[model samples]
Target: MERYKDIDSDSGVLGYEINNDNITVWFHGSARPYTYSYASAGSIHVEEMKKLAHLGNGLNAYINNNVKFKYVRS
Candidate 1:
């Protein structure tokens, strides 16, 4: 996994990793990570997530507002 870029968020999303088909997110105080995919969130949402992850902003809000329950916890 790649290193997670730190971001400012009140949602406890510490960082994220974007892959070809999935995204793994690290929460501030959680031991487990959460993963989301195009299947669950759709292609458009996945693309937007990738953009937000690269920009190092709005990922938390995007997930919260868009795909909060669409992830698989690991």
Candidate 2:
């Protein structure tokens, strides 16, 4: 996602998700519950994009190179 100038970096991670029929986005702090649906996912890394496409649903997850996210809509 494009950086939000007003977003507080230490407050959370800002992310987006794009599916065939919808695009969603949200953010969460390190110790807070994940929030979703405010924007769209684009220009993400190829492998991450592929992983997200395969999952095919929405999810609240951490972004980790080793820990894969689940339920992402293709």
Candidate 3:
């Protein structure tokens, strides 16, 4: 997984791994990674997540505002 930039230091996200159709996010104080896939969170969310992950900002907010609890697994 790639470490999250958290440019503003206000994100709960600590790291993330992007895949063809999914994203695995690791949050602060979490021992497991949450998986949000195209099949679960939908292609739109997954795609947006990939971009946010790369940008190192807004991913946590995006998840909270849009895809909360949409992960397939942890």
Candidate 4:
């Protein structure tokens, strides 16, 4: 997992791991990670998430606005 930039210091996301078909996100104060996969979050959302994860910014807000509960597991 790579640390999330949270460039503006306004995100709950702490870290993230991106895979070809999924993204695992770790949030502040959370003991477990949220895994959003193509099957659960949809290919389009997951793909966009991959880009956001790599950029290290806006992943949290994007998840909140788009796929918050679309995670396959936690």
Candidate 5:
């Protein structure tokens, strides 16, 4: 996996990895990662997540508000 970019967030989302079908997130103080996908979060949400991930803002909030508990812990 690629290194996660540092971002400003209050959701404990330390960083993330984007891929063709999934977004894997690394949380602060957590050893395991979580993966969200189109099947879980929908394509629109996934796209928004990609943008937020690139922007280093809003990704954590978006996940909490929209897709919380919708990801697979890995």
Candidate 6:
């Protein structure tokens, strides 16, 4: 069983379930779903998931990184 911290730390994802053939990642407060198939122990599929997680984190970082507020003088 996986810990909730692992899932909570991952943005847009609520949790994950590992099965024999694949892993299902729960997202959007468990409203959306994504499935991923597993390959060999050391395979591209695993790497792909890692990349996706990184990309997701990067996107969140980019969105939250900077902001500007402006007001026009009357």
The residue pairs found clashing in candidate 3 are: none
TM-score-best of 2 and 3: 3
Ranking by lDDT: 3, 4, 5, 1, 6, 2
lDDT of 5: 0.79
- Give the whole-model CA lDDT for all candidates, comma-separated: 0.78, 0.36, 0.93, 0.90, 0.79, 0.40
Model 6 agreement with the true structure over 1-74: per-residue lDDT tens digits: 23223333646554455565544555555545445554332234534444544444432232233211111112
- Order of quality (TM-score): 3, 4, 5, 1, 6, 2
lDDT of 2 by residue, 1-74 (tens): 43323232342334554544333444555333222221222334333533443453222233344223322333
Query: TM-score for all predictions?
Result: 0.79, 0.22, 0.94, 0.91, 0.80, 0.39
Candidate 2, superposed: residue stretches over 4 Å from native: 1-13, 30-74
Q: Per-residue lDDT for 12-36 in model 3, tens only?
A: 9999998899999999998788999
Segments of candidate 3 deviating more than 4 angstroms: none
Instruction: Please give the lDDT score at residue 40 for candidate 1.
Output: 78
Kindly report which residue stretches of model 5 are placed more than 4 angstroms away from their true locations once superposed.
1-11
Least well predicted 10-residue stretch by lDDT in candidate 6: 65-74
Instruction: Candidate 4: give the clashing pairs.
Output: none
Q: How many clashes (backbone N, Cα, C below 3 Å) per candidate?
A: 0, 7, 0, 0, 0, 0
1 or 5, which is superior by lDDT?
5
Using lDDT as the measure, the top candidate is 3
| All candidates: CA RMSD (Å) | 2.3, 12.4, 1.1, 1.2, 2.3, 13.8
- Residue 26 local lDDT, model 2: 46
Number of the predicted model whose TM-score against the real structure is largest? 3
Candidate 2 CA-lDDT value = 0.36
Write candidate 5's Cα lDDT for 8-66 as tens digits: 43556777889998898888888788888998878888888888888777877888899
- Candidate 3: count the clashes: 0
